[model samples]
Target: MNRTLYSGLWWLALPAVLGRLWWRGRKEPGYREHWGERLALGGPAEGQATIVLHAVSVGETRAAEPVVDALLKAYPDCRILLTHMTPTGRATGRQLFAHHGERVVQAYLPYDTGSMTRRFLRRHRPRAVILMETEVWPNLLHACARMDVPVVLANARLSERSLRRGQKAGAVMQEAARAFTLVAAQTELDAARIRSLGASNVEVTGSVKFDVTPPASALEKGDWLRSHIRAGGPERPVFLCASTREGEEVLILDAWQRLADKPAGSLLLLVPRHPQRFDEVADLVTARGMRLARRSQLDLDHAIDGADVLLGDSMGEMFAYYAACDCAYIGGSLLPLGGQNLIEACALGKPVLVGEHTFNFLDATIEAVGDGAALRVKDADALANEAARLLRDHAARMEMGARALAFARRHRGATLRTVELLQRVIR
Candidate 1:
């Protein structure tokens, strides 16, 4: 369907959207509090030219960090209007940009109906609208075009799978693609895909996520966490499953269990992608007869006492987990959920392992494996074997970690390149 039909359907689906929000709000109360903002009914921040940047959820919000910083530095006189679809993303935006004071204004991006889109644009009067990867809304793009608002797709990527899905929509996606004033893609493959989808102005800008340097404080905290987890004295290998999805946790646990003769005090850090699933994952670990420690329970003495597993249940602490671990199994790939960012682990100089499905970060994963920075296993059992072997062989693990750091360092200019593109948009 085209933009007209899509907009009509979106309008008709508002009630369903609200119902879904109500359902999600039962587990996460923050969703219940932001109804007005989702409808463009919130109060606006007066003064300063606004540039609206949309990051859909937690991952996108995190990836936007460097871009946000660059934007803040480049346009000190302007206010950054950050918009998000999920409560987690909103919370992250606030946490990340709180230091900037009123310079950063955050709210929900209205649903892609003409009325809501028009109302939001009218309210913000933004100089330009920048959308994080893969957030192509036909009505929103159409509305931006009509209002003469320049729209940019930053750190954009379109996998073969996503391209095929877009092909199903045909003209709707093509029209939406045309609305991008600039498409700063993560790779040349992404640039080609976006061009195939009818994006005219596209550039290969790598991934802005690569530009995010883990602060010294986070690294120090990670060192402390490592010591805290191994408080009983024997230094054990720490394995991290970062940003895991639903089915992957069970597979990960099974893999961890299958490892023969794991070192005494070997610790597995399991981090779920969603906050609501923290308790669920912790219970899963307990059900498997493993002692679980939650990161949220600040009492490290009590939390880690005789624990085999540490549940990374806190928000915005992914870097600490990456830093603390000796080797990491980047999650979401095992079950075809299109993988989380493996770059964070690599940046911290950790040996990385991933499952077969990493199409979400296909280029990065392929490059990492090719560079000997990571190992990709076929299934859960292979993952267990690889992790076990790497843990046992310190020299091999350190070699891989060195490669991982080199791989990360080589791809570090995307944020600056994207900011250059944004400068042209504002100009």
Candidate 2:
């Protein structure tokens, strides 16, 4: 519960952690060695203050992009280092911020061993470390605390599952959180969770994800997708199953077929969760005897009369895809993975129907439901009927879409408030 205990565990766990990292380095491509890390922290390159932001994966990395961009602009003399836990997130970060990367580098978070954490801290010598979301590694936090590097946790959300796990490891995790000089939580519940974890200087700062200024290209792409799929006819209902995990594709496909009799030209757009599974998903679609067309191959501005299902295989285009659909089923929630962000779809003005197992985005889901921006379904059958009815009534769909957009707009400034408090942690 104190610094001594926290650092002691980190010391005892160092050997096992380093051994695992060294062993796994042989199997993982992005896990290769980084000598530059030593240089990165030894001191600032020239006249820049060092700042490190650690985000576990793609979603968190994306959530921090605006903040990252804003920070780089605001602190012209500061060097920003972004660390990601997953290869996918690293790749996305590299692509998204290629220009800033020279000064703003991206790297894997060093394994949570005292030595590795010490070495990482010594190398990057981050003047400040801002941890994104909920990664509370003991050794690293202790190392930062020892070195007096201010650590701030920002845009944090605590779901029931994560909170329970944190409580089970309450002693260490609480100390780890306490090492931080500041904590910016996404909601009131999150602020309480952090405080209960022994995190002081905690502030409720909404969700930065709501502050995303989606690029201009999303509208262009959305319009193209809409006209192409509808074939220049009346506005059609497209039941988009977004970020679907493995095996959920079949249930979604089945649901689409179940609604076949309800409409004349309704369509389904299926987007699997990962880019690596694009080919696999395409194979599954054809194997299931469903006709399909790829988004890249079709001219979205025109019309495509041949496709029954449009596969959204492109990466970084979810905004456009969400915008193109009339009604959507946010995946992960339905097939039991606890769900993806329906708030994003709603932010783009699409009425979303989610499955009952949405533990991750419970608050956002509840708020959307209360606002009439989203609908909840138990399984494939209910999802099908809900889609059919919404699709049949254009006016109703439009109204729901308006409500969805309005809800998104209402939750806008969490990121700014989060950053304002976070600045205190650094100084």
Best by lDDT: 1
Cα lDDT, all candidates? 0.89, 0.79
- lDDT by residue for model 2 (1-427), tens: 5446656776687667656656666645454455334223342343456789988787888788878877777677777888877666787787778877576777777766567688878766787888888778787888888999888888887887888888887577877877878888888998887788788888888888888866777788888788788775766678888989988887877766766566777788888877767787888888878788888778542345566788998777788898788788998887668887777888888988999988878888899999999999988888988988898888999999999999999999987787777666665
Writing each residue's lDDT as its tens digit, candidate 1 over 1-427 gives: 7777877788889899899999999999988986888887885664579999999998899899999889989998788899999989989888888988888888888888878888888877789999999999887888889989999999998899999999998788999999889999999999999999999999999999888888787888898888787676777689888999999999989888978877667889999989999989999999999988888874535548488899999888889899888899999999878887899889989999999899999999999999999999999889878888888889999999999999999999999999998899884
Steric clash pairs (candidate 1): none
- Which stretches in model 2 have alpha-carbon errors above 4 Å? 1-47, 99-103, 231-235, 299-304
RMSD of each: 1.3, 3.8
lDDT of 1 at 415: 95
Clashes of each: 0, 7
| Candidate 1 residue-pair clash tally | 0
- Backbone clashes in model 2, listed as residue pairs: 41-123, 41-124, 41-125, 42-123, 224-300, 332-339, 333-339
Give the runs in model 1 whose Cα sits over 4 Å from its true position.
Answer: 300-305
Candidate 1 C-alpha error for residue 257, in Å: 1.4
- Residue 24 of model 1 has an lDDT of 94
